[model samples]
Target: MEAATKPKLRVATTSLAGCFGCHMSFLDIDERLFDLVKLVEFDRSPLTDIKHCGPCDIGIIEGGLCNAENVHVLREFRANCKTLIAIGACAVNGGLPAQRNHLSLASILEEVYHAQHGLVDGFIPNDPELPLPLDKVHPIHEVVKVDYFIPGCPPSGDAIWKVLTDLLAGREPELGHGLIHYD
Candidate 1:
């Protein structure tokens, strides 16, 4: 009965190959946040990460796919998250950093270390846990099918809140277009 007593919205948010600005923006909901705590439980995210994605009513994913780990996480998110939402430009079109796709890996490294920073060390440690940078960054949809998308480099806090609340009520979030388009 307690299970039914609690609001039945379970939500999880994860950050992939992008900065955590999107997640931080979601946190900026401030006073409105406790409302979600009563209605929805966060299953995985930097905020309340229990490691695994777990099963949830909705999944909010920020960032793009850049390497093997990203592919694995994105797929897992797709499997566990019932209503998956791709949050931010990184999830939509790989974002600005993805522009590196236009250049070679060696060029990128050389520029970052040898040319720009003028560092002698460009060697990578061969730790098993460390991820090797991929040839390019990729949008989440490129790797998995997404149920919805919230566009913006880092979507406004109001945007994230509206989506979550609407989804919780089993209503289709009214997506405003022009400057903003919910996918």
Candidate 2:
């Protein structure tokens, strides 16, 4: 008898306003990444440098939405991915960037461009190529329907691996104790 060949899961990933730490944690899987490839394959990700996402079984998002481009990319992922997972504090709750949400956009811009205490670039940057920042950063769920969340400053590599394996196995992911935290 011959063993059946299981369909490989297609995955896509991206970072928005985040520090890309979640992706780093995913990479922390290190040698386990080889085992992962046996069960899945990347579609659009930093690993592949594929500019656009195609149809994928899972989409892992690693940051908060902070600009027009982020919103656009997130929507594109939602359209192309069957399941979307928000990873890290940034993707779940805007993370470090959300600290600026209390201040108005103008004030933040003024601090960056006109503050006497900082680098004295006298004018606010108005580059046509840059995407405009939103008034506030937002969690992935605010922008799209997130199928799952891996919460942490950056969820540990082991935690991420467990989730991925469980999802691939068609089981609801069981987050063990100490796997999730606010800080």
**Which candidate should be chosen as best, given lDDT against the real structure?**
2
Tell me which residue pairs clash in candidate 2. Answer: none
* Model 2: ten consecutive residues of lowest lDDT: 1-10
Best-performing candidate as measured by TM-score: 2
Which regions of candidate 2 deviate over 4 angstroms? 1-4
Candidate 1 residue spans exceeding 4 A from truth? 1-7, 177-183
| C-alpha lDDT (0 to 100) for residue 182 of candidate 2 | 62
Candidate 1 positional error at 137, Å: 1.0
lDDT of predicted model 2: 0.91
> Model 2 over residues 76-104: C-alpha lDDT tens digits?
99999999999999999999999999899
Q: Backbone clashes per model, in order?
A: 1, 0
Q: What are the Cα lDDT values of the candidates?
A: 0.82, 0.91
